[model samples]
Target: MSTENAAVNFSELVNRNKQTLARLKESPRLLLHRRDGEDLVLTTAARAEQDQTVVSAATRMLASLARREPGGMELLLGILPDVFPWVRFLPEPDLHAFTVELVDTMRAADSLGNSASVAQLLITWQHTAEVHSDPELLAALTRDHAEDYGPATNPRDVA
Candidate 1:
């Protein structure tokens, strides 16, 4: 979809459904902006399926390349910094581990036809890097804690 005309208020779908659908015909996807919560992407089933197909094929190819070639994983590692500069905050060993886990998770996600795990993995790693970025927080997290405060509360139990 063209970025210029790709986004429209979510109300367009509720009030001007037909016009919004027409816009989909011109561009394969639409970014629906919402004031209340997270924005959403609108696209035809065909387009979504096509995107999944591409992701699956590309991921499979990368997996295969990594297995067959000695430097394939290294090649991906070399580019990760450019694509995700936040990764620079991660320690060297963690960076390598992250790359390995990312590829494995991506392959599994593509096989399952769901990218949630991949997104979650990235978020988890990003949070890790964020912690490592802060010295006091990292030390607090890594330091020993022998005393038990209390039973941990479940997030769902909170109002």
Candidate 2:
């Protein structure tokens, strides 16, 4: 089975059901593009399970490496720039914090079979990096305001 994901219009699958199933034989994974909604992924249950297993194993290995080796986390932090170029914008302390959070979140998310959480964490960190990368934004954010804003409200409470 080809490892590459093949994409086809959602209509193609709806109109040519048999042909689409045949395409699956050539490529184990398929991305169904939809005009009006979120795109859908199609793959065999076995393949999905295998992918989850691989991700889980990798997460466990990463956790183990960080725990067992001296200066292990530093080693991992050293490679963050390569994995995410935007991380270069983060200050040294923030960068270290991000790395620790990322590894922990990855391990937790993988264990729960919830990759979405990992993705959200990355997005949140990337946006933080973006702010740090912009000189004006960083200065504006860091500047002290004399104005006393009233009580702070918890975001969770608003919802």
Candidate 3:
């Protein structure tokens, strides 16, 4: 969607989901805003729970925004503690798909003038990609996952 549409849609969505939006606004780690278009997007400064009610709510809100704008959706999926568990369990193909979706959403958000969201997505993508590149951190994450989940069968495994 155009930046103008994104902004309008974002404002409308926030207004519609006032409660959840309010909670998100309260989060120090989240960047929620509307660009110029009818697009509404949420960008996270860090990873959040994929399965958390709030995250799910945000996702739903994004979906609604997409429907309203018909241009697409913008979302930044972070690799924070809450979301790691679910993302880790995703199959490789699924994980890649998720990444694609995230990148696309971020791009759309950026087009709409949501700098905070864009920055958050960039940070998250960098962190996740870097974490995989670093053997030490990867090993530590694996160990932690194993400790929490009773044996890490996959790098994506979460407790």
Best by lDDT: 2
* Model with the higher TM-score, candidate 1 or 2: 2
**Top TM-score: which candidate number?**
2
Q: Give lDDT per model, in order.
A: 0.89, 0.91, 0.51
lDDT of 3 by residue, 1-159 (tens): 122211224455556766554545444332335465443346344433432445445645664554555444323233422554545544466456666666557446644544477467646655666676678887787674423446448866756
* Poorly placed runs, candidate 3 (over 4 Å): 1-95, 107-112, 144-159
User: What's the true lDDT of residue 38 in model 1?
Assistant: 100
Look at candidate 1 and tell me the lDDT of residue 59: 92
* C-alpha RMSD (angstroms) for model 1: 3.1
TM-score of each: 0.81, 0.89, 0.29
lDDT of 1: 0.89
Candidate 1 on 72-145: residue-level lDDT in tens?
98888888999888999999899999998998999988878889999999999999999999999999999999
**Cα-based RMSD of the predictions, in order?**
3.1, 3.0, 16.9
Cα displacement (angstroms), candidate 1, residue 99, comes to 1.1
Residue-level error in angstroms, candidate 3, position 68: 19
* Candidate with the larger TM-score of 2 and 3: 2
